[model samples]
Target: MARITMKFGGTSVGSPEAIAQVADIVKHTVDERHEVLVVCSAMSGVTNLLTEGALTAAAGNPTRYQAIATHLREKHSNAIRQLLPSDVERISIRDEVDSLIDEFETLCYGIYVLREASHRVMDKVTSLGERMAMPIISAALRHNGVSSTTISASYLIVTDDQFQNAGVLFDDTERRIRRELVPVLAQRIVPVVTGFLGATRDGVITTLGRGGSDYSAAILGAYVDSDEVWIWTDVDGVMTTDPRVAPDAQVLPVLSYGEVAEMAYFGAKVLHPKTVQPLVDRNIPIRVKNTFNPSFDGTLLTHEEHVTPSTVKAVTAIRDVSMITVAGRGMVGVPGIAARTFAAVAKQNANVLMISQSSSEQSICFIVPEEKSASVVESVQDELAHEYGRQDIQRTWADDDVEIVTVVGAGMRATPGVAARVFGALKEASVNVLAIAHGASDYSLSIVVRAADTERAVQSIHRLVVLNGISPNVHAPEPIKNAVS
Candidate 1:
């Protein structure tokens, strides 16, 4: 029997019907004699509501948080009543749900008292979503006659104390996971664990950043040495591009870990680089499936490359980002201009999504989220003020209206003329290239263009992936519109 870790996303377990489907899938897997471990995200929209409730409380609206708590109470209680038919079971589950909601109300009240929402407080508030979900899902599985138990990831995942974005302490985390999960699986019981949260050495709750449930799954799958990981989400699979931008965009049936890693790193939201890093290291395969469409094998990501003639697999745009440039004649041959510039941005807690420097070393350019652009510029300006006086740094500025359109494919490493085709497409579309960056791995080509040109630019590069690659996609994936539920 294959040991599999199935991770259900928020929408997959969002409603009573959704949780019922999740229970059926687990039962099927267990009936097939496979040792299954299920990881689940919070019900859809619950985390967002929790976040809003916290912010509203901090804004001095205790009533809004109370309203949020009530909404949550109704939501979870309704799911329990619908999923568990026995009156005794339903009442017992509602009490558990109410207790969790009471804890949420208390924490939000604490935030109202403080009048400020700190990262630590935010993590705690957001974590309750998953904590509330596990018990309900486990109860559903039991109702289906599948032996199952609920587990909080805080007991299984060991991480650092970085409140909102804790990094996993892999060695300790692996030890805890096997110690906790193995015995349950040995007893032929499925262990339903909470996703997206962990605890520090001191036992303080911490969350892996937003959309970290996938990362949590990858880590657990790797640590337990599972045969495969199935990421069950709402989408059919990884699409060629955001179909909203390109009408012809199709779901990719197969992708290499390297290709998806580049896509995630460059800005495709379906998966993030950290989510796949562990799977890549362990050479484990991941199947991105639709909980709604279990019959279709959404997308199989493996270590071995797909032998296709496509030079570029996918085109993505990191939208709503701004670019900053530091340039001066005196900055040429300056040893610390690049180093010092980044250090200053890092001090502001700004993430540099892309970096490109002039060959002459006279200028350095990087991309940061638009929201953090102003603060980054102000911080860099202050830190490099002395250089400005010396005329070594004549200008340090940011371009607010830019987007990074990146085309990724491992095939580009061996294929010649791919770069020419990319720029040629942009030129053909009459889109101006503001700047460009290509990694040493030769997996992706990124170009900066005006925000107004984002749609046109994304369409252009995506057309290239189609002309170069889609013809040979032997394992066809379903269209997003008709994909399962």
Candidate 2:
């Protein structure tokens, strides 16, 4: 009987039927005498619809945005009507949902007149999804006789003014959340809060960027000092690899914080990288569970957890990446050349995926998505020519045909020969490793290969590192050479 925070994603609570499924899970946890905090994403397609409405309005047509908001409002009102029998309760939920939609209309009107999308305005516009969702979920829980109250996460999770991907001010957020939420927990009233949204100190809406819901749950879990945070998604658990590409990808029973962080960074979709930091700092464990499979024990993540011998936890990959290399003689002794290069790329709104620099400082390499490669190259060249007046800076882009494959496991850190085994498997499949990057942590290794060969590379590596549980063979040490050379 411990306090826990459980967050469900969009697909998990997309409809009345889905909300009912989540209510059932919450009821069970509450029945077990554990204090449960439920967080929910907007229903499926709701956010996308809202975004489309914003885009349409920005194109100088307000009717579509209005129509979409009205339709979405009616959808939630209908769900509440169907799920809640009490007239008073139904009216309350309906009013709350209407107010949120009204706010959306106001935002749409701004977009229509201004014809531009600002980050702060977009944050407010997008937050309506969670705003509409929390009430319906709370009403469903109540209809099922569970004591639950819907709380807007914006009021709880405080962040800076950076509208999207805002960095959380932990001390301030923790103080406020703990002060406000402790009383509710004491009364055993389940607070069903919205995830993926937060507010600044001045009451401006902000978001946690992509996959913010997971971060929301982790932040709340850390602030409340809860024993565990459960992220209930559509998947069974974190798999050894993305099961879609690699059919034999298996679920990892348990993973260390380092292992999970690496996978999340390299392309595992189960948890967000930002979510893990709060939990890791506080030593709070996270459990990844399937909303549909309530009885299954999901994968557990903790700090420094031991790994089983000869086991690979999961394989993950991200495709359609382009590697960009900048090499020139002028770069050899340059001090701020790297900074200028990255600044130019950032100015183009291009994301720098992975960066590698030569020891001699003569070259620097980075990866970006294929779509941005040309623009990135132009931006880098222009910046170099403008800043240094050097035409010698050479730019080359490679393999818009590449994917980054990563294999993650805690055991890999303590177990020798994991890297050798990974490369050996790729060798067996005749997959060429374009570039390799591994950190000192040794929990994971990443390699870039041609996009066409991604599936084969994943399958081959999965077989060698995961199924066979065999490390690659190592060569004997070479004899020491004389200093005469």
**lDDT of each prediction vs. the true structure?**
0.86, 0.81
Q: What is the lDDT of candidate 2?
A: 0.81
**Model 2 lDDT per residue over 284-325, tens place:** 888887888766676778785555445466778887678888
Residue pairs with backbone overlap in model 1: none
- Per-candidate TM vs. native? 0.94, 0.90
Best by lDDT: 1
Cα lDDT for residue 474, candidate 2? 16
Q: Write the per-residue lDDT of candidate 1 for residues 206-318, one digit (tens) a residue.
A: 99995689999998888878788889988888988888889888788888888888888777867787898888898888889888877777888888766456678789888
